[model samples]
Target: MASALCCRARSVSSPILSSARIRRRLPLVGAFCVISLGLSNLCPSLSFKTGCAQSLPFVPLFKSKFSSQSQAKSSGSIRMASESNTVPSIVVYVTVPNKEEGKKLAESLVREKLAACVNRVPGIESVYQWQGEVQTDAEELLIIKTRESLLEALKEHVKANHPYDVPEVIALPITGGSTAYLEWLKNSTRD
Candidate 1:
């Protein structure tokens, strides 16, 4: 029975499969595995990729959306929330005509956890056209520091509480800045 397995041998044991044999056999196995992975990526039909499936190269069949840098940037400005250093993250510049009202609103936002903190700079002179009327007034400016994610909620809360029929709640993206400060902002504004 042992003699049939060997070309010629008495007490000599056979070496492992040759490198050429391994190379020839592996491609077939690799092809089978690739097909299996590809099949799992396709669902509902051959043409439609499921929500779980994405088109990327030289990576695993599945990867997280957060792992995709392009998606992260396009969704919103990506701030590296580095908690290691001391820096201030995104600070929204808020303008309101009344100092007292502005301070009140800022405090409310911070107390409600919509904002990490708010600082009021009183006595800002502003001139703008409202309802086709050019007007000038002494306005208070609020510097609000918080995470990028909470911008929407902050806007809504500000508008709801602000005295003006239309409030100035704008988010200017922080492209690059101190990483440590950004991290603090991210940490402070969590659900």
Candidate 2:
């Protein structure tokens, strides 16, 4: 086993093996030292790799088990709650085939109070598989900001106005934001 490892190391271009490459071959440096020491007694040539392996420090391959509460208490850190009870406002992303449709949809959503703001991002190129065929087209992307409660109505509005059979309407939650902006976003949307 030691002969094969030594041969593999020697066969490579570099005369001296790097510490990273050595660590990859042998998980524990100490275990490799013991095995190589025993093999060196049988064959004197294996002693060089044993000397090289001992110089590199052992790196932990896995993370240690720890509790967040205990770690916080020890370090004098304040840990925030992982989950909150209040429903947050979110940004809805929608893609339309053209700018006209995008503008119409954006205006309608904001006018209806389904969204507080709608930003039209033009010249978006989309490539996706549709009905078992790969298709590519220039598109306009709408970034709509609104409350979670108005999501159903917003979807219905888009469905009614959208030309495509299956439109891209997806909501992503806003975990946190500027306090004033969040407050304004909440106030601007429908009750």
Top model number, TM-score? 2
- Cα-based lDDT at residue 80, candidate 1: 46
Sliding window of 10 residues with minimal summed lDDT for model 1: 1-10
Predicted candidate 1 versus true structure: per-residue lDDT over 103-184, tens digit per residue: 7888888887777778899878988899999989899999898867777888888888877888877777666655655666
Best by lDDT: 2
The TM-scores of all predictions, comma-separated, are 0.52, 0.56
- Flag regions of model 2 displaced more than 4 Å: 1-87
Q: What is the C-alpha lDDT of each candidate?
A: 0.65, 0.74
Q: Count the backbone clashes (under 3 Å) in each candidate.
A: 2, 0
Model 2: residue 80 alpha-carbon error in angstroms: 11
> Which pairs of residues collide in model 1?
81-183, 87-181
Off by over 4 Å in 1: 1-89
